[model samples]
Target: MTDILDSTAAGTTRGAVSSLFPATIGRFEAPEDRALIDGLSRWVEQHFREQLGQRPSCHVYVETLPAEIVALIDRLRDSPVIRELIVRQVPAGSGFEPMKHTDELYISHYNKDRGGDQGLFDRHYDGNLRFLSSSMVVRALIYLQSDASYKVVFGDSRVEKAFTTYDFGLLDFHRELHWVEGNYTPGGPQRILLKCNYLVTAPGAGARGRFALAANTAVFYVVKAAMEYSKSPRTPAQKAVGHLCNLFRRLNIVHPLVPLAAIAASAIGVAVLAYVVVTP
Candidate 1:
């Protein structure tokens, strides 16, 4: 099978620099592969049907994916063109190295529904290592089928972009405020998106960058816990915790530090509880 970059697709690929941030977002038509697209569409339909039912979306880990899908992702991650695109966006004299391993790769499925804002995501920055600056992370989306929905991005200005079957788009995680829109038609087509994230580090960042990565790795467990609470909060306390996390998620767009403060408060509360339990 031809690699994604090897396709003879007719359209020109392009990248746009954000006016307000040291970042870039772009879209390009992916290589035409009918069988591959069909396979992914089928997988999304079946997986969501049996696993998530009417749920708007679900994340399927990379390791659990079929061999072909994994191969495609591997090819995309290692693509030299993609690497060059990312490198061009970084500041001059800064190092640009894409990490070899990532735990943030997943297939996201937006299941079909009868309109209204039920399955759409709201304006929010893509989640990344909160400690790292926004310019250090890259996010990619590969659409598997055509849909009427639009991916709206807000940087210095508002821009709405549409994706068709096999469209590849990249985003500056944490720098771009983005969300999905226009999926409200009754019984609209389901959207299948393959999402991937990469971490970039300047060599000069050195020990501090390593420390940030390690800290973020540990924090990912907390994030998973919050996701579980949000998904299925069985008790009153759990429900409250879920609501607080949701609030933080929304407030994060106002300023990244807002979520950091929330995390700090939660940590302090836990520490106080521990101290009370252990004290004589």
Candidate 2:
């Protein structure tokens, strides 16, 4: 039951960036190895169980996926439309090679009584911390098993839709604000989802690019640390991409204005830096 939104497949025309949001270029069910994903999911659960015991939420990370899954994801990554949508329209660093595969795989497990999902009731973004790299952190979600009760909520109007097993979803990790819904069931059936995080390096513009990357990363951590400790419980350092968006509430900025403020600040900083570099 591939939920294809339109006829656009790999050959879909690239849509304009400005008009792309809320547009579903592709949404379809793809073939998956259910048994393999099941084994993987159970393995992940047991791994977390050993460490954390039977908790309400938990997850495990891996550097690789079953060969079959990887092959499918690789095909999706090769899609020119997906590449342009995720890489070209974002603030990715322009130097390092694009499509560099990292040893990063996330398997999230959520059950009624045991599993780990932190922001179950709250909307949040997904990402990892990168040091001194202006890379666009993008993730494509593949639902291995999702309960009928759960939905991934997004969009300006807070649209929500249930995720079916084998359903694939794409979102801008850095820009889109989304979260899981229907986690209140404490003793319901278990659910699992696989996430692949990929990095795209921007075309490095010599020293300027290097400086920008370093500066951007530095600012991110500084602001992150300042805001992180003020709100919810923190995660492991490696996993703590620092919930930077939560800082918006603490700063009293309206939810809708958060992105605008970030963009404005970035533009101003770049302008100031450029003036300094050129005025000599």
Candidate 3:
């Protein structure tokens, strides 16, 4: 202790950046229920599992956030600290928007055999995956089942390209977290980590400036996506709306199974015509 104090007194301070980028991974004790804004996450995860049956769809992944956390986010979005982090402006053609990070991200394993559609699957849903060229995604994950189990690696662009296959090991890390710190860009910034809960803090990673910033950025995108996916359509007229949504598919407008409910008016029209002809 005295030696450490002496070093501090000598002004041998440490760096505030790690090889990691925007943010770092950590775990804080969530509230008892673990349900809140994440109601959407559960819904989205389950829906994908049911429809895709564990196919390797880039669209399927899971993030589980509990409620007391929601309050934390609501508070941060309005906080001045976050105000400093957001980009107020960018080039018009950048196809990007600045966002604020005010919430903790959830990273839960989503094995179709393990947790395809649990009870909370059917609920409000609102979220989307962030991707570049529709091929890659910036992802964050944590293993609740174990602590200090394994690390999530983010290599330099050269390293990532050289590697073609990776072991999809079971996420058994507890109190430990995993995250990636690269975008679709080449060698932009790479600092990902697999660490204990203590290592996941903004300041902790920020202290070393490794994965913290990237992790922070990824969390922001996840929150925004979730908010968008959970909103429900406000009417029973979803049939018309659903058709409108599928317009780009160019499926036959009305095939044998368009559903009686969907064309109730048309059904009524046909019935009236038949009745009049028979009476005549």
Off by over 4 Å in 2: 1-32, 45-53, 64-120, 127-136, 156-159, 200-280
lDDT of 3 by residue, 78-158 (tens): 332222221111111111112223323322222122111110121111111111111111222222222222233422221
The stretch of ten residues in a row with the least summed lDDT in candidate 3 is 159-168
Quick one: best TM-score, which candidate?
1
What stretches of model 3 exceed 4 Å from their correct place? Answer: 1-23, 60-150, 154-280
For residues 113-227, could you state the per-residue lDDT of candidate 1 as single tens digits?
Answer: 2221222365666553444642255666666666646554554336556776666666765566777655445456665666665555443555755665555445554654565
Candidate 3: residue 268 lDDT (0-100): 90
**CA lDDT, every prediction?**
0.54, 0.45, 0.26
The CA-based lDDT of model 3 is what? 0.26
RMSD of each: 6.6, 10.3, 18.2
Residue 215 CA error for candidate 2 (Å)? Answer: 8.6
Task: Judging by lDDT against the true structure, name the best candidate.
Answer: 1
TM-score of 3: 0.23
**Better model by TM-score, 2 or 3?**
2
Candidate order by lDDT, highest to lowest? 1, 2, 3
